[model samples]
Target: MDAETNQSRQSALGDLALVVGTLVAVKQSVLPFTIVYAGPVSTFSAMIVATFLLYRRGLNWAALGLRKPDSWWRTLGLCVVVFLAFVGAAAGFGAIADIFFEDVGASGRFDFVKGNLPGYLLIMALVWTHGSFFEELLFRAFVITKASTVLGGGRGATLAAVLLAAVFFGYRHYYYQGMHGALVTGGIGLVFGLIYIWFGKRNIWPLVLVHGLVNSISQTQRFLGA
Candidate 1:
């Protein structure tokens, strides 16, 4: 490649690095002060900044799988598929978990989220918005894609990228959920990664739906004391 093109690519990557670093810093800073202390605003805000930066650098929405799909209905159908896959996987893993690990720290999340109806209602909204939108943008769109390229693009790269994202996803939950919860959440992250692969990295609508639904359902179940 020519020096000019190479220079442009390097500059863009440097911006991406800055974006990711800023995101981590922002998320870490806001957690102690907010009700949604997990910092969805920070995550979402960083993404907005990153999107603008990437755009200025000539990166399009497609690079983040944000393009409009050919058929919204088809994407909805894919949502159903991924959601069912997630539900089934969660149940299966839970059953297996019941056998070996008696206390998996799953109840800790429930205790934290459960509250009076008003508080619970607020939590439901936060869970869906944060889990579905911001987390997906950060983890699947930017992290997984960049990880794949950084690991050296190929089949091996894809596998490594998916697992890399999954591990980090689970690790994010580790503080709240402990080892068992982290492992299960990691498995769900793996499922999301698979869905991302199936979507051909061209559309992430289904992922957003599936991810939102998962958190919404989980919150509902917890609210119902189930």
Candidate 2:
């Protein structure tokens, strides 16, 4: 195939895979299963399909922005910035959500960890694997890359992709968190998405680290009842 034709074919496959993954997520969310099981089912199902699609195009996780950074120090610095941005965004959006709701809805899902050392420890173990790594891979890496490509691969496309992915990311939390949680989480997603584009979309390690840090802190707060 010619270059243009090959590119077109790849785009088509990406679109298909994106749609399939999204549908799977939506279906899983509404199923009778609990969030603990449903969340992983949706995430892993989408990830498996995404991986298969990428392999068909001779691409892999690296193509979805999973590569290592050139400098650990620089990446660590970026992680700090992203983490601060996450806090700012969460607080800002949370304030806005408070205006419409009595309080910004907290996910009761994590209440099990409140003042429970064992529960906190259990979730902390999964924070890196399920929360940080896979979530970023699916949301930031896969969603933004495929969305940007489908939208025509430019700055505007990337921004739009970020917004679209942020909304989806936020909605995924809606099963456990109400609209307030979705809004706050969505804002955080926007921050992460923008940072992914700003850093040239070559490395997701920084975001992954920041994500883990955020989850860890949140879990710790629950453990301490802070």
TM-score of each model, in listed order: 0.80, 0.87
What are the per-residue Cα lDDT tens digits for candidate 1 across 1-226? 6677566556645665765676667766765664355557667776787777768868865877778899999998888888888887777766766666554565454565564587678777877777787778777777777666665567887788889888888777665577777777888888888778768388988888888887888787777777
Residue pairs clashing in model 1 are: none
List of clashing residue pairs for candidate 2 = none
CA lDDT, every prediction? 0.73, 0.79
User: Residue 84 error for model 2, in Å?
Assistant: 1.6
Choose the strongest candidate by lDDT: 2
Model 2, runs deviating above 4 Å = 1-31
Q: What is candidate 2's lDDT per residue for 1-61, written digit by digit as tens? A: 5688568647854665675466465557646756555666566677777777778779998
Tell me how candidate 1 scores on lDDT. Answer: 0.73
Q: Rate residue 12 of model 1 by lDDT.
A: 44
TM-score of 1: 0.80
